[model samples]
Structure formats: structure tokens, C-alpha cells
Target: MSLPPADTAPAPEKGGDDLATLAKGGRTNTMGFVIRLVARIPFLVIATRLYGAEALGRFASALVLIEIVALICSLGEKRGLAQRLSEGAGENRSAEVNLVYDGMLLALGYSAIAALLLLAFPEPMFPNGTNSPYDLWLVATIPAFAVTEILLAAQAYRFDIATTVRTRAIVEPWTISIAAGLFFYLPGTRDAGLALAFITSIYAGLLTALWPFLRTYGLPRDWRPAPRAMLGMSASAFPLVGADAIERGTRLLDIFILGLFAPPQAVGIYYAAQQIASLPQKLKTSFEPILSPVITKNLRIGNMEAIAAQVRQVGFWIIAVQLGIALVLAIPGEAVMGLWGPDYVAGTATLAFLLAAEVVASMAVVSESVLVYIARKRNLAISVGIIALQAGLTVALIMAARNAGFGDGYQAAGAAGALMLALAASSLVKALLLKHLLGAPVSNWRWPLVYAAGAAVVVGYAFTFLPEWIELVVGIPAVLATYALVIWRRGFDEGDKVLFRKNVVPAPDASSPS
Candidate 1:
């Protein structure tokens, strides 16, 4: 597990290799984002139309426990692998290859233990479904889920974002969507059909991710990952694992709490809104794989300013894109939720809060990426605190709503509102902490965001006269176009074009305007 000497590590790449790689990855991830957004729609439609809210709610609740366990088993390879690999940048290629292999080995080991535990004590994980095999399918997906992460992380290190685009954005989602459709037509499968589809898609995506890894860095010929090294690597990643779990756990925590206090239908409605909100949330994640290596390389040389500029640049890019998406989706919130079915339109207000949560939380996500490298423990503490506050507020608000005689749907919306308030508060705290740590702006909140918000509001209101179908179709595009035109003209500078340009060398890192 010992790394090569720091003195022997390769010097940072000169020219614009890093930025070009980032730009290429950015384009790939953006394309993936759009594909995923589209692919996810059918799955949502099927879940709503065929299964109903109660069934979907049970599936979501079960899936949450499975995902939490998978995240635990992954040991943060999704983000931590980049940090580990970047540390060995100048070493032999075997070091990089072995890093990925070792991560997979460790993830599999953890997943094996987790799967067995879930099987032995399924009652705790799936309260009402201990006798059902649906929970078995959930545990079965862990290996594919964990290994897919490791391979995808390895390809990301190679700046091969297209592979992730293909596997994750295209193969995984479509596979699940199509599988769900097929399962729906079969008798006796409706209750657990989505679960089966999820397991199948994970395996498919695993295959797709594996091909790229083998093609790029064919099975490390001579390197047999030692058990000691694998264990040490897992131990090392525990903090990252915790941070990642907390970060993702924040979203699921709300659902878990709601399932306890609210009915299944409410959980389903809120989960539906959560699905739509998560699309813009994907914009933040798409930036992470590309940003990690760059930040790690700069951190190695003590280049704080370059790191800060990259953070701000990427942060602004995320905010702009997420805000525009939030506007487009949330402005037509009721219509968008109605796409699921009439019952889901109750989640319209919840959808807006969830979308707003994503908008502010983008800064917190970018800020934490910095802390992952330099101040991981501090980052872990903050993440724990954020989730804690969210859980407390969610429970308190839900209780108050119930005490005030609000319906279960309103109680669910209360939970969503609490999440929004918590995330906004967390973003402010993290942005300030990152600003202090980097001694430069980690977020670029400026007049452009204000102007873009105003423009979105104006355009959103203007579209009220349109039909719901027209509002969803023409209004969304119109709002996006209006927002993008204004933001592009006013907010984006020449340097900011790095986000969109393909394979073009960016100016020196220092020259990037924050």
C-alpha cells in the first residue's frame, strides 16, 4: 500500500492537457446528463402508471436501504480512487492500474460482507418484506454496483468520460427503463419489477464500464493486489466513504424519515419529485470526476490560487446550468409532476423546494471536493452536521404539520421544505469555510445569477397562458433559451468558454477569470 516517493512523482502536465481533458469530460458528462434525463422519464412513467404510488414507495424505501449499503461497501472509490490515482501520477502505469484493481477487490470484499448481512437480517433493512425475494435482488446488485463504480472511476482518471457517458448515462438508465417496461407486461412481477430492472441494469452497466477499463488498461498483467494493501486501502477510504455516504445519505435520509412518519403514497409522491430534482443535481456530480485529478495535481504543488480559480470557475458553471434547469423544470413544476399521473401533481410544491435545494447545494458540493483532498476529516464533520440538521428539521416540521391537522401530503412537503432550508444553510457555511481555506472565492455568486433569476421569473410568468402540454414543451424550451441567451451574453466571459469548447487548449490556469 506504500506509495512511491513524492520526489519521484511526475511533474504536473504542462500546456493545457488538464483543462482540455476537463472540457472533453464536461461535454461528455453534459451529453450523458441529457440522455439520463430522457431515459429516466419512461421509468418514472411506468412506475406511476403501472405500479401506483404505494408500490413505488415500497420499492423506493427498499432501494434506499440497498443504496446506502452499497455506498458503504464502495468505500468511496467513486471519488477516492481519483485522489489515490492522482497521487501516483508519475509512477509506473501499473501503479495506476493496480490502484483501480485494488479498489475493486476491496469493494467486492465489502459488498460480500454487506450482502450476507442483509440476507441474514433482512427484517431490519426491509421491515415488511423479509419473506419476499425482492430484498435478495437488492443485495445481489451490490457487486455489480460496486465494481461498476471502480471501473468508471478508473476510466475517468484516463479522461475517458465518454465511457461513463455510454455506460452510466446511456446503458444503465435505458436498460433499467426497458427492463421495467418488459417486466410490467409479465404477470406477478409488477410489485418487484422495478427492483428486478434495477438489478439487471447495474449488471449491464458493469459490463459496459468494464470494457473501457480493459481496453484502456488491460487487466494488470503482473500486479496481484495484496490482501494487506486492499484492507489498508479500505481503511484509508473510510472517511471519504463516510463523507460520500452522508452526502448521498442526505437525500435518502429524508425519504427514510418520511416512511416512518408518513404513508406510503406520500413517500412515493415525494420520491417522484426527488427524481425530477435529482436531474439538476447530476450537473454537480458530472463535474466531480474531471475536477478531482486537477485539484489533486495542483494541491501537490501548493498551488492554492489555481485550485481556487478552478473551484470558482466550475462552481459558477454548475450554478448557471443548475439554475437554468431548475427554472425550466420548476416553473412548470405542476405540469412536470403531472407527467407521472394526476396523484403526483400534489408534489408540485415539493418539487420546487427540492430543485432549489439542488441549486444552492451545488456550491456545497464543489466546496467539499476541495476538502476531500486537504481536510477530509473536517469535510466529514461538516457533512455529518448537514445531514443532522436536515434530519432534525425534517422530523420537527413533519410533526408540526401533523399536529396542525395538515394532510399526509402536506407533511411530506414539510419534509421537502426542511431539506431545502437545511441545504441553503449548509451551502452558505461550506462556501464560507472553503473561502477561508483557499483564501479565494470557492463560489462565484454575482450579479449574473441575480439577472438570470429575474429573467427566468419574467419568462416563467409569461408562459402561464399556455396549456400544460404546451407549457412543458414550448415553455420549457423558451425559458431555457431566454435564460441561456441572457446568461451567455452577460455572465460568461471568453475564459468561461472552456466549459463548452472541445479539445481546445485553455489559457493558463491563472488567467481564468473567477
Candidate 2:
């Protein structure tokens, strides 16, 4: 018995392409985020230029629902799907290829059923009897959108993130904004542009998103998954979905629930603050695609030590970056919200809560990604219980605030903070449970907490001496860059520098450690 030839085997991935893969996707997403962040300014400028507050609030409310629905449809399968395809390739290469086809069909089938049901029963689709009939039209695109999601997951398994980033983070949002602008310019399209943009952008992005994956995997040409196989995969997937819903609901449920008591305008202001806080969140999430496949494959091979190590490494990396971003945003939350609209300034308290929650939430994120692959069912149970607890707390808090003679804005802000705090608590609990189950110190993010606080204080002090706009433009980057540079020089392990070599060779034309 001899070993397989080098050429016939999988090429060894230096630094495992973990950082490079994430970097590609992160850069794309961050660019898209920056685009969206920058574009939102113009997009809002355009929207206010055209739609006014009423239309804008309605649009925000509708989008808020669409996000909820999208999260539900995703069903925690993005990472799961990628893990399956990647590990399957390692175990049985040919079978993994077929898994790709079968997985896509299963996802599309599920999405189709959900979308059609909504399309047919447009009159009361949401569980809470929320969302509009127009939203049903948006739901109709889920089948195509989710199918593309499966394709992107497949690509992620292959350690190819460029395609996923382009389609998902860049093309989709960018196209939607463009379409909204073009469509709304027409007299007849004015009212329908938002929903139409939702539908069109989903399908539009799917087209480009699927292109690369299909080129590599081909059509579902030979994929035929068994009934039990699909169900088994879905079973593992369901808890993941539950955990994700819990995670996401903790974020969005407050807005929806609180909306009943407050004016749409108040909802609009809180939502603005919510988005401002969300900027830092994307930095944390950018690592999941790269982390999932690697973690899953290691777990499959009984590499518990590796699993624990990788989880901590990825966790620290993400939290450090997210902490820095959160600090910058926290310091200028008021100024940032003011740029959105003068009225949005009322959301300063809301911004503070959400930003604080994101920093807290980052701890839960790293642990959960590993937990989902390992003790997925147990992890999910914890997530479900906590979400149930949190949702109830959020409702009671809103009720109390409303009844206590608080103003609409104050009540709305209180509800938002309570909801965010619930999320922070759940995150801490989940991390602790994950630590017990995995025998890993997933809660070893204490150093980053120090870093986040230090970054905030340092940056806040620097910006206090400067004017507002200067703080935003120069001061913001200055604070973040200083922390990043400092941390890179001190905190990071040697393995982290391997990332720099992925894109550039020899560190320059020809170089050595000499």
C-alpha cells in the first residue's frame, strides 16, 4: 500500500486559506457596506428628495420584515451547507459533487413552497399579522434567492469566496438601490419601487451569484439525494435555523413589537440608529464563511484540539476588529445619526444600546459558529430557550415603558435597549454553555474587551479635541488605524501574519526574514 501521488491529492492550503478567503469576502462586503453606508446617505438623500417621511417609514418597515423573512428562509443553512459540501469532498469526493446538486434542489424546493404559500395568501402572511401585501411579492423571490444561497455555500466549501462576496454583498444591494432610483423616477413606479426593488434585486443578484458556482459544479446534472439524506441534512439544519432566528429575532423583534405602541416615525428613527450600530456587525460576520468549513472538517476528523484552537483564533480576530469599529461608532453615534436626518438624533440612546449589544454579541457569534457544527442540537436548544425568554422580556419592557408615562421616543428607545441587553445576556449564556460542552475557553475574549474599551477611550479623547466633521473623516480612521496597528504589533500570534503572504509573495519581489 503506497501513498497517493502529490498531484492527485488535495493541494495543501497554506494558512489554510482561512484569512485569504475571509479577506476576499470581507473586502467585498466592507466595500459594499461602505458603498451602502456612503450610498445610504445619497439613497436617503434621494428618497427624501422624492418619497418624504411617510413613504420612507413604510419602506423601512417593509424592509425590516423582508430581512426577518430572509433570515427565516436561510434557516441557518449557509454555514451548514458549506460544511457539508466541504467535508463530503474530503470523505467522498464524487459524492460531494452530487451533494451540491441535491442540496441546491432541496433548498429551492423549500424556498418555493414558502414563497408560493405567501404569494397565494398575500392577505395575512406574517405570524404577527404584520408586513404588507406588497411584502408577499418580495417573498416570491425567496426560492431563487435561497437557491443562490446554496450555490454560494457550495463555493464557500471550496474555499472560493470571491463569487459569494460579489453577488451577495456587492451586486445585490448596489443593484437594488440603482433599481429603486430608476423605477421611482417613473410616475407609475413611485409607490411600488421599494417592493419591486426587493424582488428584482434578489433575482438579479442570484443570476450573477450562481454563475461561478454553476461553472464549477455544473447543473444539478447528476445530483439525486435520497429522501432520508435530505431529511437528515434538514434535521441538523433546523436547529441551526432556530438558533439563527433567535439571534436575529433578538435584533429585529424589538422594532416590530415596539412599533405597535409608537408612531412609524419613531420606528423610523430607532431603525436608523439600529443600522448605524450594525456597521460594526458586518466585520464580525465576515469570518463565518471561512471558519465554518474548516471547523467542520476538523470536527469530523476528531480534531477537538484543532477545533478549539481555531474557534478561539477566529473569535479573537473578529472581536478585536468588531470592537474597534463599535468603539468608533459608539463615540460619534449622535453625530452619525444626525447625518441621516435631524429627527434621527432622537435615536442616540437607541444607538448606544445597539452598539453595546453588538460588542457583547460578538462573543456569542464565534462560539455559536463552532457550536452549530459540534453540539448543534444542544446549542440550538439553548438558543431557543434564551430567545423565548428574551422575546417575552422585550414585550414586557415595552409595555412598562409605554405605561410609565414615557414619551414615544423614550419608550421606543427603552424597548430597544432592553431587547439589546437581552441579546447580550443570551450571548453570554450561550458562550458559557458552549464552553462547558466543548471544553474550550470560548469566553477568552476578555482581552478584546479591554482593547475595545481602550480603543473607545483613546479615540473619544482624540475626537473630543477636534471638530465634528474632522472626527468623522480623519479622526475615525485615525483611531481605528492606531488600534489596528497597535494590536498587530503586540496582540496577534505569529500565524496571523501568514495572511499577508496570501496576496503578496516574498513580501515583495524577493524577500527573506534576514
Clash numbers, per candidate: 1, 0
Task: Give a tens-digit lDDT track for model 2, residues 256-326.
Answer: 66555566666667666776677667667766766777676656666565556556666666666667777
Cα shift from native, residue 7, model 1 (Å): 28
Candidate lDDT scores, in order, read 0.81, 0.65
TM-score of each: 0.94, 0.85
Determine which window of 10 residues in candidate 1 has minimal summed lDDT. 2-11
TM-score of 1: 0.94
Which of the numbered candidates is closest to the native, going by highest lDDT? 1
lDDT of 1 at 268: 88
Residue 364 in candidate 1 has what lDDT? 88
TM-score of 2: 0.85
Clash number for model 2? 0
